[model samples]
Target: MSDKPLHPRTRAIHHGIRRSQYGEMAEALFMTQGFAYDSAEQAEARFIKAGPDEFIYARYGNPTSRMFEDRIASLEGTEDAFATASGMAAVNGALMCFAKPGDHIVSSRALFGSCLYVLDVLARFGVEVSYVDGTDLDQWRAAIRPDTRAVFFESVSNPTLEVVDIAGVAALARAVGALVVVDNVFATPVYSRAVEQGADVVVYSTTKHIDGSGRCLGGVICGTRQFVREVAEPYLKHTGAAISPFNAWLMLNGLNTLDLRVRAQTDSALALARALQDMAGVSRVVYPGLPDHPQYDLVQRQMGAGGTMIAVDVGSKAAAFAAMDRMRVFEISNNLGDAKSIVTHPATTTHSRLTPEVREGLGITPGLLRLSVGLEHADDLIDDLRQALA
Candidate 1:
């Protein structure tokens, strides 16, 4: 079974199962901080030279966490993965593991506000970081320097949903011997081929689509085994950024239906985006599935679908707020990729720390509203939006 190349859906269900003596149907949660040994000599041998499937500490590894990591890696087509306490932990770990003082990084200017702080504030302590327009090949080309250690970007950026050319940027990073790191939240793993397209590392906030129920805060960094086990695991375990066994269990359950939920939400998002495209007060609609999107061609080639998120410029902040307040079904919130529909105002919420000028540069306008479609009926959500806009 280990040598067989099963489909992703199959792997998600059975890839990392380690049955106990009881041979339970579901993966068991160890919920332990440390493991015990039979004798002093046995403990010494285990520590000195661990076997193929040995456990040292919960922070280092656990049965539940390992199951979630293995399942996600299989789904993402990566060699291995490291689960983290939260999405930001995954983001920070992925970048901090391979970077050091005097190192340089090139990244997209359009990113989640927290992600921006990680690169701009944290990385600035030692590493030199440069920001560029992710969609422009020329900007990325110019930003890559001989000293660039890595290039990072949200494959489909946050609120605004700007799609980056993963293959193109990966090519540039490869030429400069830099790793290509992608935060593939918007491009849910169901619709993502970042690895196949050349991404060296892919990060996800399992808090989002992976735990579609909004029940847990978890994240994972997926990449080659050497990078995941050797690089990410060391930083994560030492710094105490490991996901809880309970959270890992929740995420593992979430993975079982990730494909179905994301696809359903994406269908609703497409319908809603199209329904509101020419509606009154909507100045612009940004959805990769739309022909008018700047990177629609690339989106079709790379993602195969527009995805489960949509962004709209609703004329002004006042109008955007009015629409949000009027919506009965869509909840106004900052968190996304949940079972419930969520709307966010990036300029004032997620990206509020950025100056108006910087926000504008990223197309995060005062009137822009980001909609994360959920498992609601398309017509119901459309009608709610219609009444709100009316």
Candidate 2:
């Protein structure tokens, strides 16, 4: 066979497949927690240093989980990966593994509520974190100190839909030898070139676009083999953050159609964003793909597509709730990247935990409705939003 790399679509389907003696057509699920050893000496030797195909405990690793890790690593163009119980587990493990008491970390101020909570947890543990406006390169440059251990940010800010300059921030981090850790859930693996753009670590919530149907919760940390095996794995396994084999299998299957699902959803999102902008009730529409977005050029350079989420301001909390109530096709939920379109009032749902002042600073207005566009036809979705706005 010719020595050539496969396309991402092909890799998503065929990579990391391990078939059993039965030679089953489908990927077999190995659900056992512990592996039995052939001999006492063999078990000791394996535990001392498990080979690529060996496993001692489920919390440490499993064949099905390994398959999910390998496939995602390949897709993300990373040397290795570690699957976690949820997206937050991956984020916590990635940041907390190397962050010490005195170590300083810089982060974009616009982050998911849970991510902010994790940073708070780290703060209580003595790690110093500085927050900066992610859209401002100057803010990032000013915040990163010589002692900065890592810089964390959502590649695309949640709810408000601000797109950060991945390459610009990565360059700043490199100057101080700080690791660039990116929450790339919004970018989706299909549109991400985070590794190529100089990110040291890329994290994803497989429950979102990767699963594509809101079926299960899973997350993965993708980076160098040293980071995955030596740094992240030790912390995650010891803390019991391993993804269930069943969830891993579901994520593996989710990867197969990720490209198709995300692209379709993105198209629907753009349509809705454009329609919302001109609608009578909507005062604003935030989507990276829109030409008027503050970071439109960055979105084109980085993701090349708008992505599957949009945020619209319908004027007030009452108006937002009324619009959501009037929706025919969209479901009311906090989750994004689902096959069924979703509408969430961020001030009341996802980001409600944040103080009102903080939410306003992040542009999560009481009137803001976060839209997760689904696989439905663009015209149908647009019509649904039109009536909702009407």
Best by TM-score: 2
- Error in Å for residue 88 of model 2: 0.5
Model 1 lowest lDDT segment of ten: 1-10
| lDDT value for model 2 | 0.93
Candidate 2 structure quality by residue, lDDT tens digits, 1-390: 988989999999999998888997767889989999999999999989999999999999999999999999999999999999999999999999888898899999999999999999999999999999999999999999998999999999887888889999999999999999999998999999999999999999899999888999999999999988999999999999999999999998898899999998888788888888889888888899999998898899999999999989888999999999999999998888889999999888888899999999999999999889999899999999899889
Runs with alpha carbons beyond 4 Å of true place in candidate 1: 1-4
The global C-alpha lDDT for each of the candidates, from Candidate 1 onward, is 0.91, 0.93
Residue pairs with backbone atoms closer than 3 Å in model 2 (clashes): none
Over 42-158, each residue of candidate 1 has an lDDT whose tens digit, in order, gives 889987867747887878888888889988998999999999999999999999887888998999988999998888765667899988999999999999998899999998999
> Pick by lDDT: which candidate is best?
2
